[model samples]
Target: MSVFAARVCGFAEGGKRRHQLRREGRLMLNRFLSARSAAVAVAVGLAFAVTAEAKTVDPKTSSIVRGDAAALGFDPAKLDVARAALKADVASGKIAGAYLLVGRHGKVAFQEGFGVQGPGQAAPVSDETIFRIFSMTKPVVSVVAMTLVEEGKLDVDAPVSKYLPEYANLSVWQADGSSVPAAKPMLVRHLMSHTSGLIYGFITPTAPIAKAWAAGGENRNDLTAREYAKVIAKLPLKNEPGTAWNYSRSTDVLGAVVEVAGKKPLDVLVKERVTGPLGMTDTAFFQPEAKRARFAEPAKGDAGVYYDYAKPTPFLSAGGGLSSTTEDYLRFVLMLAGDGEYKGVRILKKETLARMRQDETTPEIRKAGLFFPGPGMGFGLGFSLVNDDTLQRPGNGTFSWWGIAGTEFWVDPKNDVFMVFMVQARELAMEYQRKNRTWIYDALVK
Candidate 1:
């Protein structure tokens, strides 16, 4: 990839690694990240809320209803190019296995799986293969936060300390390993857009903050989300809150904020509002022991797993902790595509979804720290919006994000197109995203 393309995160590049099943029956886990930004689009259209009580979308939501190339406004010949190119990646050993589901006009035109489930797992990947959707978790949690905002349980403009005082009076971290008082308090909105200045402590093992966090037992799974936030609260920040759009543990902090603001734990809030309402049955912080076999592992030597799915751990990493199936996540996406309502279940208002897509950062802030969304994009509540197509291929008003593992999704309201591409190739997420977009764009005749 070109240097510019390599910087496409949310749209990110991948590296190689492998891991065997760890903890015996429990599977190992790892985290990966992507960043990209975009311009806003007009709301597709306001979807009227169903008057009847909301219900979980059936588990077999849209798979059986997939349309054909001609019927769905796609060029069959061009789509074959996309098909062959994706399968070629498996032949080249770039990914262990993957599946891509493409939809337009509320119907699927194409969906297919590509390789074996994992390193030693014999099952071939299918619609049900579960993935550790690292940074993609950010958008899910952000959507949940908006639900709270809609309910008046949380105020985006309020200081984060309103909910968690532990985050109060925090200092900024300087390059020289010294600290100074922050110019202003971090706001709830800053946490959602990644401008809170609270970065991942373990990103650079040798960094002073990383060392400090490790010494304070920050990585212990035994710590609850709230306790994890407390450990982060005592640390200095990378920059002033709301001043820079650094990819940090801001969402993780938002989890704690949600707990205090909603008077319930983060996982509980997500389940009650998002997963449960939308029938995203397989999406959660921990995978069940019976479902461990369905977990997709990265190619050998590509990445390491961070959590054991069989055990109930306490650290709810709202930033990168959840595992989900393509079907489960697709229901969540349809809600966004449907302007916050899936099937009959409404989780957020159309205006709130649009608000999430509007740019929330300045150009200077996006470029300030670890800016990974690449050129021609802008940061929104949790995902990147394409202002224009100068840097990437997606249409204007397209919003998207991805996991560090070879997983990505983009919804182009303008084109009535969206795709969910899932893979365990931690090192190839960016290449795959660009490839996936190109394939879909070329294949579409609409």
Candidate 2:
């Protein structure tokens, strides 16, 4: 039986409880029909109200129906089905444990956890499970940079060398693998859009600099942000800063730059300006001793046991290293959904949020798959732009980013939906997983 099934069996005791179970259970079973049926789309006002309800409603309420789910054009019964499907999938080894939270407008319509924290634990998953949200950290870093932009501390168009003069002399890689002088310097915007010529050491095997990056042995585990920046400064840049699009360690570098500009540690600045104001207490570069027990170990496959990184590293990778819980991340998404406000806690101006969402890439680079795929989608400041079908669902104006360790989150302002799925496994079957996830959304909103 599925986890939901097992849990429900415990709840279906005597008298009125049994009757309630039968009614809700039967309704849930019929959700597949309601999902694909020709019911009219939910009204915009109701959808908004439903999402808002999710933000405020207590989780201890009845499981048969959720107020916000119903308002967002989802049948409560169908939502139950989706929940069951998610549990069934995870239990059967389609994936390891996963925590899902979906909301519309500013409210969360559904929050559920499935499978075990590890193999032998009987305690079911909860909202507090900590996840290593690798690349998702990029968005948070980008938001920090934008916050700096709002404060007039940085400019998107200006050359980064203006702030760090070391970049003033960067050169490009020639066809023969030798360095050549660049006509133009790398700019802050180049780093943001990934049009800057810098390269991520992991992507290319034949490039000499790639080899250097591998052998540099910078001891990322022991270096602080300042130390990492100093190590990177001595390396050769892959290309001229702005001539082409290349995914690089640009965001982490940007984090170092943020440190330089803010005159504080990256973690400290993020805590003060972002997570603190947004109430994401669980998000941090270093896990507190008490919370370390809950950190989900990264795994290579569904059945493979999870493991921590082999090295004892100290550097907190701004591009990829924040650990957070589904609830904490959902709160971040909710703030974005609310136009930068959550329960009157505003971390950014509405206008600044608008800028972050705007497409920042050119047409040529977008077609080259320099960023995410979707119609009308492109890379914005930090998150993947939803401009094409691959990144978008039925809704337009959606954006998200994922971690290497199977954590994904997206915000759809057009549909007023924010969804997060956190897991510990690596190399997920993304297409199949996305199909299943979309099926649930379609069924719920139908």
Candidate 3:
């Protein structure tokens, strides 16, 4: 959920400087790093200024430093092979464009951009190309919700009906299509954990509730968050609250909970609480017309989900609607890696973050559905918790998530490592995430 390094020294510095970090006051130690490394690390919680060595953006503050792959304990030539493989995908037009970033010991090793901005477009992808991060937005919203939880403004145990009463009498849909009242109240934690029985239409396209959603126009962009929650509440749920772990609209409902609890719109709450303080300048529900040209495109110009990014919409899909750049999103995850503080700004407390990373589901609940985290992972408050090395993933204590349109990220506090992969090809997301993990983990030779 979040990590902190205090009074540290010589991290991932080859064998030349193997000094141990003093776990003093945790986050306060960030102030003790050497001026240059401290700047790079803070830029990583990263102020995320991508440079030409790795394509940097104009920084609002200190810039993130890219490390030598060999010095960081990665085989430079092997790493090159991995990069070449992805670059080949771009060249073959398998994906529109891509950006990959890997950071370890609070310092990034590389950030690479590939191919054209998208499809047949003339622009090449750069450090600032914005992407539709889709479900990746959930983790951010979950962070924002946790911020409110830290402030004592939101209660994780409280019934969703407490914030949005529309959820109070929600109905559960049976296989035979009959509905019954929920056996338990859907709590705030349920929404964050996607155990609220509110499944996504696309994920449950064959379900009766999914059909109801389609006919009821639940996907309308014109309704506000509260109105959208009302529409969702009226529909029958896929299961009883907390009984199963289904990929859901729960985060979208949590957005309404956040809006009602925080007394503001989802976008405003995110800005004022999370993104603004962390300097995630390019992360938002939509981009301004000025920044529209920087938006990434699909192989087919109009095939991507975001066709109205420049237009106004009353409801921002807190679960699946956000556009961001690698640098901006990197800053946010770096903040998580920094234990909820970035550039000296504290969002959620370290203990709160720890709670979010702890496992929240049983094997029975996970076995109930597709269980997107795969073999070794479990669902946490808002992330996939890596509990074992059973899968070709990171070690235990890694918490991560990804966007539907090929954007994936993971922060491994145990290894002081994290990665961000950005691309606009929806079909390649799962495929690339699986491949990139091997490419990255194999290179972690030290």
Candidate 4:
């Protein structure tokens, strides 16, 4: 039995206090009914019933369950220790709340929630709580583009201007406040791998191009995808396309390309090609009115501001505009872990997924140390590929990424396991993500 299962079983077996409490309550009820008042007896009985329900624990459920932790080759004790540490972190006020799910060999061994959703919010985080996944949306968008690639509707190596004419000619920004024409056109693959020389305006407010981006108001919810693209194209790029690895707004440009190729709005195309097929009903650019109660509030100390998921935005940021529940995202990761199919719903062919997972960072970029997330990882088509086991705790070949609001997920194919951690605060996101990596790997006995 898994440690969680065994713990539940042991509690049931040793619950003498529970039985004694029930017996005593029953006797008191009978005495009250016989001697004094029937109303008092009913009230006492209801109290006892509530107490009993409070002590019960529900069984864990997963879409796929091959075996328990021990049967799947894991140390239950080590896993418990990791869980305890996460709970401790919450109690210590390092974060507001967190939810974790672990699946191995197709079976879910650990799925739990801890702490309240946010300060002044009485409800605790649960499996169904929705999070602002932020940059994590890039992987899904990248996958959608790849589907077009599979259908011969799009080409990754083609210059982005082939479909989006606004990008046909662009200027490169120089440190001396001058601009030069780009030596080469930006390609689709460059956008996917974040080598398109685009930079987020919020990252460096003082840069001339960044200032221009902010001034243009490209990210306002009132702008359409094509309109956003037009504004971005007018700005000077930080580097020549495909020459340097810069964390950027390239994915947003890719979204505009997807819209042009698919002939549909990015939101509709994603629903048709990805989320709808995968049954990720809770994932979307805007949270529906009905789901407002389940949306987690961002913790007080987040470094950056976030868009209101409850309202529609003018531009669907393929880069960071997505909100999803833990359960829904788990389904998405399961599909990735299962090589692009979830319960026979094929989002991408196995070969395509393999290509997506391969590190696309050129040796030149790696040698220059321009790769985001630093030395131990390299950029893939849409995800970060683990290049060194020492830096990234997961096994090599793990594909992973996180959001600014403390949400993270990783697919470790070598270990046949995938894990996700969700929290709504950004102040300590990186710290918690790193801690989760260490704790999760420490529990892997096999």
Candidate 5:
């Protein structure tokens, strides 16, 4: 089941709460909704029509509920309970600032901004805040890559060496410290599926690639894609291409490939294929001085620790190197919901969009459990695909990817639902997964 299907199942199990928003008496639905709310609701209905029957949240209801979230989806009794628990954590200094946006179809029914910006600041978070989207940028990069595919400039199944021949002689890691030569070259699909033997340079505590990645060994933000590929060319892959699934810098390499294939810089390719078409004006690698203040300060745990956006040596990591607004990111996700088109611009073909969303991993690959565990869940091109609702949290048919700095986004074709949580809390983000993410989705299931 997809996240939307899980949401529907959650709703069915949620029982009476699903009908709580039904208008009564003179409460006109229009009075409760905002234009944005209605548009999203309509989009959700249109996008996920066949996954599982989903009902759009009325526009008026969305607006009214967003203004006063206590009435949104909370079981009235649980409302106080959940709020108290959350407040208690904040009071104990367990968190700083957190923002959440939830919408069904195309409309946002719940928007909540909570906590302080830091230890001494009381200014609450707003919707316009920016976040370090980290690996979440992977999917966006994947989208950009697919756009090239739609234009017939790239092939997901083709060997990476076809475009960057240096990758043709890559070798795999041996169990001991030695290396073994690859039987085949890494393919574009392998990179997207994480089966390209590339290492995230962060995963696998004992892996040599992990150590090298930590030392910025093969991963360097200072190097251009071409330069970065040269560095990776000298390193040994952790596994044979397509033989295992390991989160790696393969997407970043893909970013470089896009540049070579399109004869443009990575950022330029991203803009031409994604941001420009989606009207994501604020999404980019370099943040102008004027917009610097809006970029949220990343936190260590509960303490909001500020860091420079421009790493002393900048490497436009296509895998994790973009800053965006909640609204701008929403537009990008909306395009995914619409299956490639947003408003009038067609970003990808519906068929291509479907292919991107389905499981790209074989049953054998999935059974190897190289990624997150799920009953029917498997890796898609760049996002995680839902295989069974029973193994999922709330949203079914839902695909998700998050940034390292407490930012997350998901698209549930089943519910026409798309959600994003933007914050500066990194180490603290995972600590409150249930209250911060799981419960938030649980609250937005309708």
Candidate 6:
């Protein structure tokens, strides 16, 4: 049987069987720690203890019921099947480790950790294991921008050139190698919805503008957000503003806009306005050195590399730069699922979240199939909206997105479900995402 199946079987056998599994978990943890340096082992052990003590929620008022799948309206047997499938994939060596959390009706219904920290690492994956969230950072940054909007500091419909004057003279590139002055200025909404005409340098390596971005130190660690914005504005756009939807570095530009409008650094603004209010203590641009032991390592065969999470870079990529634990991010997503409130802390107004979840893509853009990777989806302010319920598993009106490093989350407001899957392997991100979605939805009994 798979490792996950064995654990589930133990739970079925009674208290004695459950005790055996707990003992086994401790034994494995101890053996893993023995191979690591003393200092590292001690730090990891402390982190594990802290995670164990943290409550998923207040049990009395929470819908979360530990190991009671039926209480949360899930079939226990199907949940077992889902766990086995995930463990089988890990055993196949496609991914190094994974963490999953499912919340329904405002409480955690299921939570599980699988595999080791990395290919050759001894540490076992746990709730506290931090993973690089990549593009998932976009949603958080978008919400922060909305908060500025609430304060009358930023306007989504305003011309982006109003905040960053360098974009005023921007031009658009054509297939015939000619350039034309943009007919209209790009708006803040365009950036948030990925209709700003910008393109990611690495997405199309052979394009002239993409090549120019790379040659100009677009990913340089020393370049500040302001400096990067200036560099990006000078490049020719991939399309006319609002004419097409490209998964671009527009959120990073939005980050620069937020910094200018909020009159603070991007990191500081995110903490003060979003994460801090939501109680996501483990989410940040720079992973602390002390928590380095708890950070997950990527798989050996990830398709692309990531920036050093432990190193502080001036760029502060709002598009794809953030590390967070499963628990910390769950709180963030739960807030969204609850329509801007979590445990009574309101990070955003209900109306703001409603606006964020609405489809912002034009039918023309959707028909052209340029908004995002999947079918039957539309682009929202900072997320992908489910346009056709028949095509995707999540109900209509769901808002979701994922990161390149295999982290994904979705809030299904229609079904009152919020699920997060955290992993460090990018080679099979979409495949794993589909598998997890299928398994989770299949086990849903409500």
Off by over 4 Å in 6: 1-67, 302-304, 389-392
State the lDDT of candidate 5 residue by residue for 1-446, as single tens digits: 11111110001111112223233211333443544466655544444342222222111211211333433444434334445665565667666666676666566656666675555665666666665566677888888788677656788899998889898888776767667889988999888888888765444646665675555455344567778877777678877788776666777788878787777888887876677656677777767778655666532442212334443234667677777777678877777777776665566777877887777777777555366534576788888787676644545667877765667787877656667777665565565444555555555524
lDDT of 4 by residue, 1-446 (tens): 11111100001111233556788998999899888888999999999888755443221333545468777767888889878987887788767778988878877877788887766788889978887888788898998999888766789899999989989999988878788999999999999998898876655667677777666664455678788888789888888998888878888889999999888999998986777766678889888788777777755742235545677757788888888888888878988998887775567878888888878787786664246576677888999988776643687888988887678899998888898888877666778777877777787777
Model 2 residue 360 CA deviation (Å) reads: 1.5
| Estimated TM-score for each candidate | 0.84, 0.77, 0.85, 0.82, 0.77, 0.83
Kindly give the stretch of ten consecutive residues in candidate 5 with the minimal lDDT sum.
2-11
Model 2 C-alpha lDDT per residue in residues 1-446, reported as the tens digit of each score: 11111110001011123234446545654573467532322333344445433333232321122347787766667667757876786767765577877666556677788886655555566788887676778888887777777666778788777677677776666656567777787777777767776666655555677777656543244676666756666666666565556666777677777887767888887876667656688888657677655766432342222324222245667777677887777767766777766665555678877777777777766554344344465777777767664543735667777776567778877666677778776566365347535655675554
The prediction achieving the highest lDDT against the true structure is 4
Higher-TM-score candidate of 3 and 5: 3
Per-residue error for 33 in candidate 4, Å, reads 78
Candidate with the greatest TM-score versus the true structure: 3
Question: Candidate 4's C-alpha lDDT?
Answer: 0.77
Off by over 4 Å in 2: 1-66, 76-82, 205-209, 217-219, 298-312, 367-376, 388-394, 444-446
Superposed by TM-score, candidate 4 places the C-alpha of residue 413 at a distance from the truth, in angstroms, of 1.0
lDDT of each: 0.74, 0.63, 0.75, 0.77, 0.64, 0.76
Q: Write the per-residue lDDT of candidate 6 for residues 1-446, one digit (tens) a residue.
A: 11111110001111123234456657756776777666765666666555433322332332233445677778778878768876887898867789888868877778899988777887888877888888899999998998888777899999998899998888988777667899889999999988888877666678787777676655555677888889888778888888888888799889899999989999998986667655678889888799877878766742226545687766787887788888778878887887876775566778888888887787886554255556777888998898786753788888988987678999987777788899877667778778878888898878
Evaluated at residue 291, the lDDT of candidate 5 is 67
Tens-place lDDT per residue, model 1, 199-290, is 76545658887676566655555677898788778888888998887777788889899888778888888887788767788888878889
Angstrom error of the Cα, residue 329, model 5: value is: 1.0
CA RMSD, predictions in order: 13.7, 16.8, 11.1, 17.4, 13.5, 14.6
Candidate 3 lDDT tens digits, 1-446: 00000000001111001111123223433664644466546545432222211221234763366787777767777678778997898878787788888878777887788887766687878768888777788889898888777666889999999999877898888878778888889999988988888877766568677888767666666788789889888888877888789888788889999999888889998886667766678888878999877888877533325445566677777887777888888887887898876665666678888889988888988887668777778888889888886543587889999876678889987777898888877667688888888888888888
For candidate 6, report its TM-score.
0.83
Residue pairs in collision within model 4: 221-314
Could you give me the TM-score of model 1 versus the true structure?
0.84
